[model samples]
Target chain A: MTDETIRDVLTRRGLSRRAFLQVCASVTAALALSPAEAADMTKRLETAERPTVIYLSYQECTGCLESLTRSFSPGIASLIFNDISLAYNDTLQAAAGQAAETAKDTAMKNAWGKYVLVVDGSVPLAQNGAYCAVAGRSAVSDLKRAAGGAAAVVAVGTCAAFGGLPYAAPNPTGAVPVSEIVRDRPVINISGCPPIAEVITGVILYYTTFGVPALDHLHRPMNFYGNTIHDRCYRRPFYDRGMFAKTFDDEGARQGWCLFELGCKGPITHNACPTTKWNGGTSYPIESGHPCLGCSEPGFWDKGGFYKALSTPTGHWSRTGVVSGAVAAGVAAGLSTAAVARARQGRAQKKAASADSEPKNPTS
Target chain B: MPLSRGVIPIRPVTAGAPAGGALADAILAEIASALHEYLDTRQNHVIDLTGMPLSREDRQRIDAYLGQGEVSMDIHALVHSHIEETAYAGVWRVRHYDMGGGVHSERIEIIDVPEIVRASSADMAHSARRIEALRAEEGA
Candidate 1:
């Protein structure tokens, strides 16, 4: 079947055992697995057959492909791409026209019930699915056909996952996500304008290693898309201190203050951008002096002016006010508990002394 | 009494943050929380440090911050390791060695009791049976 294990591939490439283990550890950590699971993951990846992945593109800008290919440090291409058998990708595959379709079909037929169907971009279904086509066939038709025999369907970007930019208002083509088309199969969404390169590879590696990872309410991997960007942002301390950058060129901006006032959607956006960063732990949008556009979240394009702060009631308290109120309440509770404990200690000591001083009874 | 060994230079443990100390601090804070979890509910946590891109100097800096505790144990199993409890109780540092005696993997493990020190139940049972058999043979 020409299936090669990860260890065999690594050894053929002259990669050290340590390097292989490191990749295993990285993927394990990305999946939020315990350290013990890393060793198990390494063993699994060592002997496990590489799964066949059929990547289908619809109405995307190819930014996700760029992110996956152009990512710098940790070298995701070498780490992840070398391990998987990418059966079909229009952008990457050498085959053209009928040959490409034949290749995809051949792979699909060979890996039936085991292959992974990864869809990028949105599928248009406005006029009998006429907006996009592959091999003169509608995108919806192709997606349904591809997803039918696949083991799992992975929505690669915001486009395929949530109908992305094309699915925005005034829908002319009536773009719909892959999930809408593939109703029977489980769709794992890795959503982002152009999702983090490592994250994309991480999710793929996780599925290839573990059966199906634990996902969030949004059908995104919990480990990567679990926490809000604001919760993990380094500038969160500045936000809590109520120190915000009023303008892009303001003094606060120079001092690396919070971007909440400048319309940062970090509080509402869930992503690993703050921690994972982009370009191999270099920096993310907030660190590069830009307010988060909340790209990863659904309907981000319609989330009222990127420069406008989130609207709130006039009397609504700020985050600082809530923090201060909680602090005060905690201090009052602490003092009351301390006072009660001290009183109890005093009474116990008094009783002990009183008993000690009492006359002793003689025993025969 | 004459000094038997040469004077060993003691490096001063500085209180101020060093370069890349913030990253280490973040990791330490995570380990601290894991320690709290262990103490509160007796849940064990194993934090793999092998995946992180930590330089030798960065590791030394983190080690300096962790300091040392009274208890340290060296284990020589299929893979050799040096396990130590950090200054903070229930927080541990476990370093596994490769065949070449170099560190293969390092982890920050949090548990109520270190796993390496605990004997396996199966081994304990086997030893109990062996001792009883020996006593029976000796008629004692």
Candidate 2:
């Protein structure tokens, strides 16, 4: 492996250290880290040994990788390429067949127990794990083996984190997520249909510089996936004001009203797509007149129709039932609290009356 | 009616602010410097809108981008003021009132803590004196 410093790499790539440092600062801000941490991250990026990253692809369409390559910012692209030693990427690497396998083997051996393993697709468990294979080995086996030698595993798309479409109803391949397969190592899921390019790079930068970032319950980085898309959406004011588009071509739609009635899944989806944006902060789906499909959430495919409003109850749970249940719970809580208070009051009164009647020792 | 069709009608372009959010983009780019400064130094920046050549539409666009937040205050000082905190913390919209109760000066102020809400030194001194008087009267 080449031992070139990040500064040396940037210099070779015709990028200034100042510009790269600025990019680092921005990435830190994007990760919601404090300015002090941003300064710390800048130093880490500048001086740290560029860690080796082995990217594994399984049952996926390669859109996740494409999103990274199609990133509009040259500074971001250079930052990613120069900051890490991406050893094995089947799509981008020049080696093929036996040579490719050999290169991956060499890279793994060289950076064993320290390299970051990035998986982009789900692993199929059916048919003895034969659905998706690399180098004649199943994804499950490959992931397990690589995870054992990895410092951490980053599941980079919805497919790898959740089963995604592959594990939707009538799942033929019996696909399972990387987290489910690799139980030993810490897995950081960056879920999206094809996650925003900045998010992908941001996660990598944060992990490499600051170790594992604060993760939410779903093991996703809290800074990126902490808030629902609705919380950070620019169109959220319309949602709050009860203005929604009923149809695609309606006046409300043209006026850029909320798409809740038109089946925006922003309320359920947790990702930085709304704030961080896609295609180099150009716009997200909701900004482009389309509703969010809730791509980041687990079992999104099985969550009924994409165009059906989230308020429209499905399965055994009706909207009325949910409301009634909440109301009943509230009433029950109030009744219980009142009863407890009355009981306590009764006990206190009884004690006071007894003391007055039996224990009046006057002037002794 | 077998005919060789040569003419095809294309949809007419809608005359508006264009497809992309150009105005929003430009405004955000303008505020980018302020944001960077705030992030870097935790300092406050105040931009007086009255000094700028912004139309009502431009102001509305800026408001939409800023979004309504938790805080909105109406102050009845010498000049009545309406202050609103934007969705993003450290960003605020403040407007000074005129004699006729219309907006005299409007500004988008970015700061760690807005100075408008804080008590002035003179006010604090007066408050201290009042407290001392109250304590004396109460035989403290």
Candidate 3:
């Protein structure tokens, strides 16, 4: 692909060519595409028209927005605003009051069924959606309005995708996800407390490029959320060996043993954190000595404590009438020793036996 | 004595902080300590441990200890039976006993280990080494 087109776009947006190429490379790596595919992607990106995006905020903290902003290395916010035309975002819009509301209306009217709608945070439905209101309109009302003519709805963060903290226990606001309110269009759930920056950008890129990437049953992008963090965790070897961290700063933790015992949700949580990581793919929570909270999975908030170990059966040795704890330990020790002795004796015996079994030489 | 099975060597702790000295010296010391521990705690009363390498002797001893009645050495079989009995539903109980006269039973449940850790130990070790290298680079 000619760098001129990309460079032109970057120059117009006041972003460096290096930044634009970096975004392409990041997208390629995020999608797990080959180098050739990445080059092709760069070409496509250069030629493709920037998709229209409308971001909606509902009943929750702006943490998701903050996290999205924190996406380092060609930063997702920069890509979205500069590469793609972000039509309406209540949080970041320059206009305010009636003007701000008019901008959203104008964009929706203009784009009409050709825009991608991104919803962050959950919509409160309790009390006829009275819990959260914006500009004399309920959050639900606004969401329904925005989602009516959208090509696709992307539910960003756990709040928008799966209720998040707003939907947690005693959910006074009666908050619900975007999918619950808007049922007409296809909904892509990028679930996470505050999803990985690359994952968020990757989803957007996939949609922009191929038009709606493959999704799991949970409506998550299969590419980024298909595998469990435990599967790719660095401490996995310790798990296999039955070595575990009993406490946060104990010997096992210092040794980088599996955090299964200390309530790591990695075993059950599925995400690209271990591979895609955070801080520009620098390191994930697990590598930073924190257990996975399984933010990407649905109903994670309702699930038991974040620190609880995934329930694993103690194995057959603990069951049946074979041996008790002390007895088993003793037997294991004995059997191991016996097996070793037998192996050596067998080797020596084989040598002697072979010598005896050899046919006599004609000369002898 | 019957044929001896070669010992499955215990890997030295590789991820911990330096064991009170130079990295190389600490690693060597850790390996030696692991070997010593393997030798001391591995002996089992029931096994005939003659005519085997020291490592093999240690392994056999440990295996014998595990196979004994006290610890319910057949944990895998027990877990299987429990699953079969429970029809893979509800809580399954496994009994445990302390060195004292006290005894207790605990329920265990099924968990999904990420596919990443499902690889062979050798593969996991290699991945761990790579992770360590990455950490070292970052530290540097």
Candidate 4:
């Protein structure tokens, strides 16, 4: 609450100066900046002010917050997210009811026009925004008031970034992403079913260090989302060698071949899961013997079967078979891959229907 | 059980890019270029090894190529770190390990010494003050 620098807080809070440098080095490397920037960043961050952050949840599972906070494998670098966060989320904060509401209001008022607004989940506009309410107030109104004085809006998950699962076909609640409402303030979308932990931290650290980062057309930070899973995939050589895994238990599957034939959307999806990885760089989905679900991309829940390959028909490879995701969006119209997508989608629909029909009441 | 697709008899690669050597060669080439740029411009470069798709064989090739230098040290902080200078003078390898002993972030730097090794000015000042207080208490 005082006018102390970030380093002062870190030191006073028992985080060593060297540990702070380590964090700076890790983030600098993650940003793909020169190694020298580590020292420069270390110096700058020592004097940099810790910005106030306010987290707002609209319509989401707490998975995005779970991703940000590391319970499985806690590391000092990830803990930096907590050091600067003046977060007022009901889930993590102790206060509730009027006390919690008062704290959030007071914090926002004091840090108004200066706090970083981090929002997750989509905001439903249907039913007069009655689908989701906090303290008897609609999520839409809460979001509008909070965003009114925010320095910047950080959309954490696909729900907040691109109206995730709730915004799928039929969209019962008429869910709209944060960018749709907070258009006045600059919105940084970190879209994922739950984005990579480091990517979220990396984006925030980059913002605190050097204003807003360079964004792609999706308004996502270009540094982390620049390369697709297909681009940096370790199985890429297998793909280029024309060795494809047809099923989950095929010989090629045992041989660590490309899973493009098994419905991998890596060809058209952009994310840093391949690089930053999960569970602390242990392994990603593709490496763990599963095709990419493209969970980070928009409309991922509505996308076809997770096991359908993203390639053309058998025998020969076409131009559309191996196009980069950046260009794949425009080229999807005439591609034969679309047919496979539709067929797999039908199979997926059937599977969902059968599952839904299963007895919900075990006694019945 | 009825199989989906015809199980094509997979054969050894008798065609395109050489297996195992391609990625290692690419990394080696990157290091070589980075080393040259460092020598010529006195600029430092870092290649994030963990981010790359390096197999066991690729790792062996890179390890054998770089070898090991005389200077190697372990740093303990929030995360344990092992840093080793490669046989090449200006090239160094940095491995940051999580508390769980899994490799978190690994990279190669073409610098005099990795920045993480250096003591920060704040720490140095603290050290000086602490020692000064100790000496004064002893009436030296």
Candidate 5:
């Protein structure tokens, strides 16, 4: 199977075999795949025919694309574009005007029922979808046309997955996500304001190897987005000690205490920010002394103020209150008794010493 | 040396809010009364006591109790009020106390009945162990 030999493919791409192996290792760790599974994936990825991907951009700032381009180690961008046959990308494609549209048409026709549709922005549905038009076609029309025969659709950012800022309050454009438009196909939502770069590449690698990565109810990869940020927050000990940062630069904040009172969305927000971090896993919002804005979860924009504390149930404390009071009282009493006893012992020791030193033998 | 001591105010720690009419109000009143008793006893102990260093066992017991959230302890009245207003459906007043030569205050709020009892029971067990340790230390 010429397609199965990844080592040969990398050599063909002018990348050393060692560099290709390193990429494979990174993909395995990023996807949390076992070593054996990773080896299998490496084999499959090296040899499989490069899948076609069509990328569409709509109402967005292109931050997601920018984040993707910033993938640090071994440069995932070069690997993705060079290894995969990315047929159409509005931002990166050489063709434009009639040529670009015709290129998209030809790719879809040739790779029908095989291509992967990747969307990076939200589609505005208001005013008969006149809010966002590409090549004189509404975003909704463009998306539907692209999705009709694609094997899968990957929503690459918060905008493409949940309408992000475009769908924030008022939503002048009446923006909707690609999933709403492409209901017929399997739509995977890789949600984040601009998701972690590693996570984005990891998802692509999983799809490239295993056909499709396991997804959560929200269509996010379960391995990465399953746990809340609070579960792995470094300052959890301070929170347990009841130390919280009340203000931006208060003593607690300076001490690197829990940011719960400072409107940290870690407890409620589900993402790998605490674990995966940002800027090549160097630091996340919480670690840098700022509270999480929960940019990854759906409807985060509408979920009250960013600094407001979540209405967590205090029921975990009913028993705690009584038990702690009694314990405190008992311990206090016991400590007092011990101190009194120790004081008495010291006094007695001094008396004995005085008695021994008395001049009773002075007459002798 | 600065004394590591604090005072806590006494407050009624009721469980949940009143449901609707007279029955709910009565239940709330009952819970408040029980919480008041617990707080009053604890305060009396604090007042009668003088400069005594807390033991490691005592601190551990207090930690265990706090973990259960059956009672809320604060070093300042402001923190107490905040806990009472935000965490519990009850009222409380701050009281100051002298610790050795230093002075500090705490706000003491009663947790709901069931949780308080459970926590208190665990605390009592811890206290028994501490009391035994104190007895041994005195003998030595």
Candidate 6:
């Protein structure tokens, strides 16, 4: 692909700078940056040379790719033509077989050590990486080759960041996240069953502008994953009031009360679902009355049942009634801390309310 | 009768703001603080309402509190951008609508005039050159 800067693309498309600034302003929100930085962001997006991206898919269901196409802000087309030159993606590209392979090879060579390497799906390490392959080469070897010349790697979706469903139990392929193989490079994980569309867009925009953004312990961008879903959930008041939905059809459920009793894992599952939301800001799983499956975290598939209350330990714990020993401990610790904080906040608010309502005698 | 910002009713806040206004209350506080920050630093700021859990009530409350101002702009590009100055002089409510007229973003910006409404120097320069060239052709 030709080295076309954003300015060149905009000018050629007959779009003015003001219009692009609007997009930049919208994207500023996506970056979790204040509007004060909109002008700065606009300048960077306008002037910076568009980066080439090589998307590598592995042992996955391609849900991540599907989710990416649903991006609203800078929708997939805008992100592709305006912000990035998506040099190669097996699913998106038209050139197939040898021509497609040649394009990837050419793009990687041309932008060596400068291109953004985007990987979806986990890498299979077992049986000499024999589980997933393309053109007689394994996903593991191909990813290492792509990572060698990449400026930074973006592991999109839970599958590539954490061994997802394929990595569940009785592992045959011995699937591992991209970070395990691409050790020398910065692998930014955009983890979710398939991360929220705008989040994927936001991370790409941030990376394109500022390079690797701040990451959490799992190497996910802190900008999008900073707060736990429960922290920002609108139903937090109900949670504070200790009102919970015991069943799917209960009055509390209709009133949109806390789903903690019904196996909602918003307290420990860190994601932007509550904020950015899904289906173009419509709603997320929790908002739609389903308990969180903890799709973003590693080993979520094996972390007990989806409807089990946190640490109640009496209900379901996966079909086998067995939880990964480590995950159980971690969940218990996070839940206890959250419970304490909730109780303390509730008490403080109650005390303050009481003080406010107390009628006072004539002031001195 | 599609539900939109315009269609929503905004009851005026007369009783010195409501009690227990959780999310809505926090947002108003942010806007109030932003108004002051702009005054001190002459810097514009934006609060992305879309990124927050802004219920319909929260949105109306913020609207009722801010009221309305004199300036409102409609700029059409990839989508239709509507920017309206709130009751507070520098505070603006910016919303972008898709082709289908669905509101994509709802933001509160504190600025003299939002950048989206202002024509850039580069665009003006380009237009200026084009106008001059037109004059030259007429003279020729």
Which candidate comes out best when scored by TM-score?
6
lDDT of 6 by residue, A1-364 (tens): 4567766677676778766765676577666675545566677777667777888899999998888775554443354433456777888887899988898899899888788888999999999999999888998899888899988899999889987777887677999889989999788999999888777767777677666666756787766776667777777777767888899997778777788889877776768888878776778887788877778877776655788887666433443222244345436664454554345445544553465353211110
True contacts kept of each: 0.07, 0.00, 0.03, 0.40, 0.00, 0.40
Worst 10 residues of 1 chain B by lDDT: B10-19
Could you tell me the lDDT of residue B94 within candidate 6? Answer: 92
Name the lDDT value of residue A350 in candidate 6: 55
Clashes of 4: 4
Could you give candidate 3's per-residue lDDT for residues A1-364 as a string of tens digits? 1123333555466444334544554466566653344565677676665667788898768877777776564443455544465778888877999999889898888777777889999999988998889998999998998898788899999899978888876788888889899898789999888887667767776676556655655677766765567655656757767888899978788777888787776755657787766765557888888888778766565555767554533232322132133223223442332344335434544553455353221111
- What DockQ, on C-alphas, does every prediction get? 0.06, 0.02, 0.02, 0.34, 0.01, 0.25
Model 5 agreement with the true structure over A113-222: per-residue lDDT tens digits:
77778899999989999999999999999888889878889899889987889988778999988888988867888889898777877776566556555565567776
Docking class of 4: acceptable
lDDT agreement with native, every candidate: 0.70, 0.70, 0.60, 0.74, 0.61, 0.74
Let me know the DockQ for model 1: 0.06
Q: Model 6, chain B: what is the TM-score?
A: 0.79
lDDT of 2 by residue, A7-61 (tens): 5565565544433543553465456554345556777677665667889899999
Question: Model 3 scores what on Cα lDDT?
Answer: 0.60
lDDT of 5 by residue, B1-140 (tens): 54433445333433221211333333345445745765676321111011112223433443333343234443321111112221343333222322221222222334332111123343466568879999999999
**Which segments of candidate 5 are over 4 A away from where they belong?**
A1-8, A81-83, A312-364, B1-140
Candidate scoring better on TM-score of 3 and 4: 4
Q: Candidate 2: TM-score?
A: 0.65
